[model samples]
Target chain A: MRKTVLVVEDEFLIAMDLKLLLERHGWWVLGPAASVEEALALMDEELPAVAILDVTLRDGTVSLVAEALRAEDIPFVVASAYDKPEHVGGEILAGAPNVGKPTDQRLLLAALEQAIYRMNGTSLPLDP
Target chain B: MNLEDLYRLMRNGHVQAQGIIDTVPEPLLVLDQNLCVQTASRSFFSTFKVDRDETIGQHLYELGDRQWDIPELRLLLEDVIPKSKAVVDYEVEHDFPGLGRRTMLVSAHRLFHPDNISRSLLLSIVDATKRREHEAEKDVLLGELRHRMRNLLALVQAMARQTTAAGRSGEEYRDAFLGRFNALVQAHDVAFSHNGAADLQQVVERTVAPYSGSPAGVIVEPGPTVPLASGQIMSLSLILHELATNAIKYGALSVATGQVRLRWEIEEASAPRLRLVWQESGGPPVAAPASSGFGTQLIEFAAKRELGGRVELNYAPAGLMVEIVAPLASVS
Candidate 1:
C-alpha cells in the first residue's frame, strides 16, 4: 500500500508542483490546502500518515494546523518560505524539520522520509 | 505666612529660579492654583513660538491663539493632577499655531508651599511626534521587505521544480527557467513600484515584449485602466509569459503572417468581473496538445487557483483563443 501524505500550501503553482512531486515519489497525496480552515477540513475527512506544511497560508499562520497535527501525534515537516521557522509559528514549530522554500527535491524527500521513519520506526520505499 | 508674603518670596527668587529652569532644556511652566502661568522657561517660549511678555500671567488655556485649550489637558490639570499630586506622562495631541500638529507627553507635578493657601504646578512638555512616526515607518518597511523576499524565493523555486527537464538539454532547461524568472522579476518591479499594485496594461506589455518582434506581432487593444494587486500581477504576468512562449514556439508567432490580439473589458453584473481575451490569428491550423504540458497546467493554475477565475482555451483551425474571467475584487 502506498503511504499517504498531506501537503499544505497557499500558492497555486507551488501547491500544484508539490502535488506532482509527491505523486511522482509514489506517495498518496492529500490536499495541498490553501488555508488553515481548508487544512483542518481535510483532516476532519481523513488523516494522512505524514504531513508537509507551509508556515504561512492565505488565511493566517499554520499554528492551528500544526497544533492539530501534534495533538493527533502525526509527524510532519515544515516547507516554509521563511528563513526561520520559529519566527512565524513560535514554539509550536520550533523543532520541526524545515525544508525551506525553493526546496531542493532531494532535501525535501529526505526530510519527509526521516519524519515518517521517526514516527513509525520504518521507512517507506520511494522511486529514485 | 499670608498670600502676600508668599508672592514677595516668589518675586525675590524669580530671576535665580528662572535661570535654573532655563538650563533644564525641555519646556517647563509653573502654573498657580488658578491655572494661570506664573512663570515659563526660555525653552518654553522658543519651543511654542511664544514670548514671555504675552505668556506670563496669562490663563494657560488662553495662550497661543487658544491652541493650549485642549479638553484632555483640561481634565489632567483641573481634575486628575489635583487628586493624584503628580500626573506623569499624560499624552496630549494638539495643533499649535507655528508647530502644526504635534504629540506631546505632558508631566505635571503639584508643589505645595509652607503656606497651605499657596500652590503651584510644574508642567514639562516632551515632543513625541518624531519618535512615534519613526517606529510606525520601520514596522511597515520591515514587513514589506520580508513578504517580498519570501514570495520571490517561492516563485523561483516553483519555476525550478516545474520547468520540464525530460527531453531538453541542460541549456534548454536553464533558458526556460530564466525566461520565467525574468518575467517574475519584471512583474515584481511593476507591482512594488506602484505601491503593491500594478497596471494591467503594463503587466501585459512587459510580459509579451520579447515575443512582440514577430511579424503580425501582438497588438494590445486600449481598455479601461485596471489596477491589480501584487499577487494578481505576478500570476497574470506568468500566465501571459506562458501564452507568449507557446505562441512563438508553435502557434501564431511562429509564422510571419500570424498575429495575436489582446483585449479586456469589465463585465458589469451583480459582482463586476474582468474578462480578458487573447486571440491568435493567421497561424498554422491549430489543434489541442496531445497531452497537457507544464505550460498548460501553469496557465490553468494561475488563472483558476491564483486569481480565483475561470479559463477557456479554444483550439480552432484558424487560431487559438484563451479567455480568462476573474472577479474584479480578486484582481484589484
Candidate 2:
C-alpha cells in the first residue's frame, strides 16, 4: 500500500500545490484541510502515516492536532510562515523538521518520507 | 592580520599620518604615548596660528593659557585613554580658536590597534555654532508653549468669575469654571507624567482620577499607555478634563440621579490613527450653552489644531457626545 499524507494549511494556493506535489510522488493524499478542527475530524476516520501542519490555523492553533497525533502514535511536521519552532517546544521541534514558510516541493516530500519512517519504528536515514 | 604586526603598522602609521592631517576640515591633532603633539592638521595650524617649525616637538603646555589650552582636557584624555575605551564627549566653552566666543562641543577618542591596545590619541574638534542656535530656538518654543497654555487657563478663570458675578449662587461659577479649570490642571499634570507628551487617555485620567469615587458613580479607567508629544498632551488633557468636569458638574455626576461613561479607541487601524470616541450617556439631556466661549473655541478649533483632528459634537436626548477623529499618534 502507498504511504498516506495529510496537508493542513489555511491558504488555498499553498495547500493545493502541496497536495499536487505529494500525489505526483505516488503517495495517497488525504483532505487538504484549512482549519485545525477540520484536520482533527479528518484524522478521526483515517489515520494518515504523516501530516504537515501549519502552526496557525483559521480559528485556533495546530497544537491540538499535535497532541492527538502523539496519543495515536502518528508523526507530523510543522510548516508555518509566522511561528518559530522553538515557540511550540524544543521536543516538538526534535520530532519534526521545521519546513519554514514558502517551502520547496522536493523538500516537503523529503520531510514526509523521514516522518513516515520514524513513525513506523524503522531506523531514520538521519536521526530527526 | 597578526596582532603584533598590526600594532607595529598602526604605531608607525600615526607617526606617518602627519601628511594627512592638513586635509581634514575639523581641527585634528595626533598625540604620542607621552601626550606630546606628533601631528597637527592644517585647520588646527591656521586656527591657533603658532609658528609651526618651532611648535612640532614642543610640549602642548608651552602654548599660552586660554580656553583652547586647558589642563582639564589633558587630565580627561589621560583618564579615559588607559581603559582602552572610545568616547565621544561634549564640552561647552565661551570661546575657541578661529571659532571665537561660542559654545563648542569637543569630542575626544583614543586610537587603538585591532588587538585592543591603545596606539595614540586622536582629538577631533567641531564648531558647534549652528547647534547652539538650534537649542536656543527649542528653549524659546518650549517657553512659549508654557506661557500660552498658562494664559489660556487664566482667561478661563477670568471668564468664569465675570459670568457668575451677578445674583447666582456659589454653584454657578463652580458650574461655569470649576470643570474647565480642573481640565486645564489635569492636562498640565498629565504632560509631566508623559515627560511633557500626552495622548487622549492621559488627559482623561488625570482629570477624572480625583473625583472618581464609586459613590460619586464616575469610574475612570485608562487603557494602554499611548505617548503624546508635549504640546498635544497639554491640549488633549485640558479638553478631556473639561468634558469630564462638565459631566460631573451638571451633565452626569452632578445630579444624584445619574453616572458618567468615558472611553476612547483608535478607529483607523491602518496608517496614522484617529481617536475613536468619548460617549457619555445615562445623564440628563445636554442643553446648548447660551453662549459659545473660550471653552468652545478650544474644544472645537484649538484642540483640533493641537491634535490635528475633526471634532463632532452630538447633543443627544440622553447625554452629550464629543467624538474627535484625528491623525493618530503616541508621540511626535
> TM-score of every model?
0.69, 0.38
How well is each residue in A34-111 modelled by candidate 2, as lDDT tens digits? Answer: 777888899988998888887666667777778788788888887754335546433454547867556655677778
DockQ of each: 0.40, 0.00
Model 1: per-residue Cα lDDT over A1-128, one tens digit each? 67888999988878988988888888899988989999999999999889999888889999999999999989999988676777887789988998887777889889999998998899888666
Alpha carbon lDDT at B227, candidate 2 = 60
Q: iRMS values in order, in angstroms?
A: 1.8, 29.3
Name the best candidate (by DockQ): 1
Question: Can you give the lDDT of residue A58 in candidate 1?
Answer: 89
Error of 1 at B84 (Å): 42
Number of the top-ranking candidate, with lDDT as the measure = 1
Residue B120 of model 1 has an lDDT of: 93
Deviating ranges (above 4 Å) for candidate 1: B1-147
